[model samples]
Target: MKSLILYDSMGGNTALVAETIEKALGARAMATDLVKVDKDLDIDVFDYDLVFIGSPVIDWLPTKPLMDFVKRKMKAYARQGVVKPSSPLLPGKFGVSFGTFAGPHIGEKEALPMTMWLNSFLEHLGYAALDQWLVVGRHHHNKEINLSGRLGNIEDRPNAADLAVVEHKVGGLVDSLSAWCA
Candidate 1:
């Protein structure tokens, strides 16, 4: 199956997760495209069977570039009249939303809104929601917050162990899909 790892990362946390996902997909022998969300990005999400969208949480929301990409796709889908009421699922198409957050106030709770928002958009476009992954990230800009956050001392997070978990999740997802197809 074809897959796309589309993400936007600030300070490299989310980027590391995205890369791990890409490698896992590769191991599964899926044809996957790894793309970083940018102002000039013009990708067709429908071209892939599975799409993984990720971002780094900024103030409890995804980065503006990734949000903008979603909005642009929504508009384009609307123009084509493909966005229907009740958003029926599109068979064989799936989406996974992932993100990195340094939840200073509420721990991982800070990443929920961002993940749900992205998943809702994918569902609105008829892709079945497969999963949501949230990883702890260090708040690099603020030394105090990084040390004092609810998730304390995450300076080395999204580390090898964290990425191993992500890789395992990806393998399980691919195996599930393979079995479903079989």
Candidate 2:
């Protein structure tokens, strides 16, 4: 099995989550790689059996770059495959999405309103989202310390305790993904 993790982070929270998932999967014969989302990303997604994407929630939705990456990548996947009569966008692979919010105030309320939109877009592009998750931590927005609905007063970046929760969540996601691939 092979897996890839693509992410865009402002405070490295999302990157840490991706790493946790990769470690938890522990694929013996898997080739796993992580990359920061680039403007001119030229990755080949067909080679991987599983993919994980992490993005910082902006304006209660995924950042524009993340959304654009999803759209472009999915479209590229579709373009490389045989086009069906009705459906045009479809990938030959599967993937998942994750977001990291501040503290513990992550609800569908405002942290990630674009979650569904991105998921639907993935499906439209032919990629199957294996699972989705959200993590809580400290994030700065608009140059101010803004908690995306999470609790606790974070004076600085997430400490070991905060990272542990993210690790646990990602570990679970990895377990479920491994079982799914099995």
TM-scores of all candidate predictions against the true structure: 0.97, 0.73
Q: At residue 181, what lDDT does model 1 achieve?
A: 80
Please list the residue runs of candidate 2 whose C-alpha ends up more than 4 Å from where it truly belongs after superposition: 26-29, 81-93, 103-108, 141-150, 156-162, 173-181
State the displacement of the C-alpha of residue 92, model 2, in Å, after optimal TM-score superposition.
9.0
Off by over 4 Å in 1: none
lDDT of 2 at 129: 70
| CA lDDT for candidate 2 | 0.65
Q: Candidate 1: worst 10 consecutive residues by lDDT?
A: 137-146
lDDT of 1 by residue, 1-182 (tens): 89999999989999999999999999988999999999989999999999999999877788999999999999999999989899999999999999998877897788899998899989998999988999987887887878888788888888999999999999999999999987
Model 2 misses residue 111 by how many Å? Answer: 2.5
Q: What is the lDDT of residue 114 in candidate 1?
A: 90
- Pairs of residues clashing in candidate 2: 90-126, 91-126, 103-137, 104-150, 104-151, 105-149, 105-150
